[model samples]
Target: MRLALVLGEVAQGLRRNLSMVVSVVLVTFISLTFVGTAILLQFQINQMKGYWYERSQVAVYLCTSFDGGPCEEQAATQSQIDAVENELSGATLAPYIEQVEFETREQAYQNVLEQWEGTAIAELASPEILPESFRVKLVDPNQAEIVIDQISGMPGVFEVKDARAFLEPIFTMINTLSLSAVGIAALMLIAAALLISTTIRLSAFSRRREISIMRLVGASNRFIETPFILEGVFAALIGSALAGVALIALTEFFVGGYLAGEITTIGFVGTSDALVVAPMLLGLGAVLAALSAAVAIRRYLKA
Candidate 1:
């Protein structure tokens, strides 16, 4: 009987302010979606960082050509290559070095051509301009700078480059965007909470006379509060459910289609992880709604 009455009152409140209820639903949906997107983007960024960083290596390009000139037979000698390899193998930091693989200019050019197949730009550059390089894989990517600095001044080495250097800017931009989304979501969520609170307060005020009569009839405070709490929870749950659906659809459409093959390094959160977070978002929304309603009702109950 108590549960039925609570449900009835909640339904009545929702019906009385249908527009406000809709506003609460839309606000919560948008806020939670933003929050979820931020989390998922962060997850994707971390995942890509881990994946790429693990495979990251410092490339030491041997000086075989100068000033856009072709490689001369006398440019980089086999002796210099062997000396570099021996020095790397004999270093005190040898244990941290995974393995050093040498790629000839021919191999590098072939790789470039293969990657740029069907592109007219590939034909513009001569393959002979490509320089032979030592691909130095390290056990720890963070130690790449140390290795690069050590190899940079070597006789035959012209440049030492780490893959992370090229990727840092892109990641920085993504992180900035994610943080911006979070900031916007926070502002919207606060507005949503305030709106929910005001609606609940109004609903409670409308029933003040009935509540006072109930109090005169010896009704407990819990009985009076349960309906309002339930109302908020129900509204939030609906909103969260809608948000989750939208999020999942957006992720699937964007990540699975547009981004899947475009960037080999970037990856999105999988469906399994998305499913795991859905319940948490829903619960979070419900909790937030209940808290907002409770706060609004506190003074009225006290009076």
Candidate 2:
């Protein structure tokens, strides 16, 4: 019987402030969507980092006849190449370098041809234009600078290029985008909180006379507050459910389908990420709603 009365009061409050409840729902939905996006983006960045960084290699380019960098008058000699190979396998550098491969000028030119296939650059490329090099895969990719400092001015080397350098800009851009999404989500959540507070205050004001009577009849504070709390909870749950749906759609259609197809080399986030984030968003909504209702009721509907 008590549950029935509380539920009835909750329903009446919702009906009275239907517009405000809908506003809370929409605001929470949009805010939680951004939150999910930010979290999934961070996951995506970590995934890419693990995938690419483990395989990152440092290319120590040997001098060529046409080289413009700090190269000798001629192409690198066989003795110099052998010396570089020896240093890579020697005890001094063994801890840093996991493996090293020597690519001849012809092999380097072929790689350029394959990579730049129909381009004008490929048409203009030649074996003599490319440098022979040692491709060193590091035990730890972050230690590329150590290898670079050792090899940069070595006899046969013209340049030591860390593959990670090319990827740093991409990672920086992704981080910036994730931060922007998080910032937007925070602002929207603040708006949702304020809207929730207003809705609860209005609902309590509308039921002031009934609350007064209940107070006079020795009704417990918990009994009077439960209905208002349920009103906020119901609205927040609806909003959170909508946000979950949006997250699932984003992961499925955008991340899984579109991005996966376009960037096949890297693994993209899937619907499982949405599933993981859904409960967190729902919990956030519930907590925010409960807190807002408690504050409003404590201030306006004091027993």
Candidate 3:
């Protein structure tokens, strides 16, 4: 009977400030959606690093006639090539090097041709413009810097490039985006909290007479406050449910449907990631609402 009465008071409180309750719900929905997206984006970023870091290699580019630095206007001689090859298989670098694939100037030019087949840039491309290189697959991708330091100062090498350097900018951008989502979510959560507080205060004020009568009849603080807290919880529950649905749609259509087709090279987040985040969002919203309501109720009673 007491549980039924508390639930009834909760429903009554929700009806008194319908617009404010709706405002709290919308704010919570938007906030939690941003929170969920930020979490999944971080998850995707971590997965991308794990998947791509293993494949990243270091390129040791041999000098060409057209190249600057170390070449002095002459192509790499056969002796320089031999020296580089010997150094690669030698005792010092042998531990770090997993496998080495050599690319000839002609092979490089054909690759450029196929890559820029129909472009105007292809017309100006020549074998002499591109440098032949050894693609070194390292035993550990993290050991790339060591290989670079050793190979960079070697004769006939124009540049030592780590492929992982290319991925840093992409990850940096994703991280920035994640931080931005978190910022937006923070602001919206504050709005939700304030709205929840305001809604509780209004409900309390409207029921002030009944509350005083209950007090006169020896009602406990828990009995008076339980219904008000439940009011916030119910609105938050609706908002959380909506946020969960939005996260599912985002994963299904945005990551799975679109990004999976367009960017095939990198693995994206899946529905399971969203499902994992849904419960977290629900709990977070509930906590925010409950705290806000408790503060409002305490302050209103004292006032």
Candidate 4:
């Protein structure tokens, strides 16, 4: 009997404030969409980091005549290149240094020309313009710095470069954007919560006379409160559901259809991730609804 009364009151309140209920749903949907996008962006960043880091390598360029040093006066003796390779092979810091390949100036130049087949610059430069270098492939890319630092200042070494160095700035920028999205989502959610609370307060105030009659007839505060609380809860649940649906659609159409193929490393929220987010959104909505109703009822119940 009590449950039925609660349900009936909830239905009545929803019918009376249908527009306000829709507003709550819209606000929650937008807020959660931003929050979900932030989550997926961070996930993509991690995925790309893991994928690229595994393939990262260190390149140690040997001095050539164009390097402008003693290295030019006398081409790096075979002994100097041998010594550097031996030092790398014996290093304890990166026991996983799988192999190092020494590319001569001619081979380096050929590779460059192959990559720039259609470029005008390729026609202007000769293979001799390229420097000889040691390309080190590691079992663990994180240890690249160790190898780079070890060989950088050595005699006949021109420069040390890590493939990952060029990508670090891009990842940092992505992280910043993800954080900014989360910040904006938080602010928007707060606004949504406040709007929900105000709507509940006004609805409860309009129904105060009905509540007074129930109270006068010896109805408990719980009896009077349940309907208002249920109204908020229903509104929140609808909002969460709307948000979840929007997120899935966005991921499928925008992320999967377009971005996924273009950027292999960028991943959207998968089905499993969507399932996980669904409950969180529902819980968030429920909590917001319950809190809003509780605050609104406090003043009425006291009066």
Q: What is the C-alpha lDDT of each candidate?
A: 0.82, 0.90, 0.92, 0.81
* Pairs of residues at least 3 apart in sequence or in different chains that clash in candidate 4: none
Those runs of model 2 whose alpha carbons end farther than 4 Å from true positions after fitting are none
Q: Write the per-residue lDDT of candidate 2 for residues 262-291, one digit (tens) a residue.
A: 988899888998899999989999998999
Name the lDDT value of residue 160 in candidate 1: 83
* Candidate 3 C-alpha lDDT tens digits along 181-206: 99999999998999999999999999
How would you encode candidate 4's per-residue C-alpha lDDT over 21-96 as one tens digit per residue? Answer: 8998888888888887787777778988987787777988877666675465445667888878777788464476
- Give the winner by TM-score: 3
lDDT of 2: 0.90
Query: What TM-score, to 2 decimals, does candidate 3 have?
Result: 0.95
Q: Any runs in candidate 3 off by more than 4 Å, and if so which?
A: 114-120
- Relative to the true structure, candidate 4 reaches a TM of 0.87
Q: Model 4 off-target regions past 4 Å? A: 68-75, 91-94, 104-126, 264-269
In model 2, what is the error at residue 120, expressed in angstroms?
Answer: 4.2
Selected candidate, larger lDDT, 1 vs 4:
1
Better of 2 and 3 by lDDT: 3
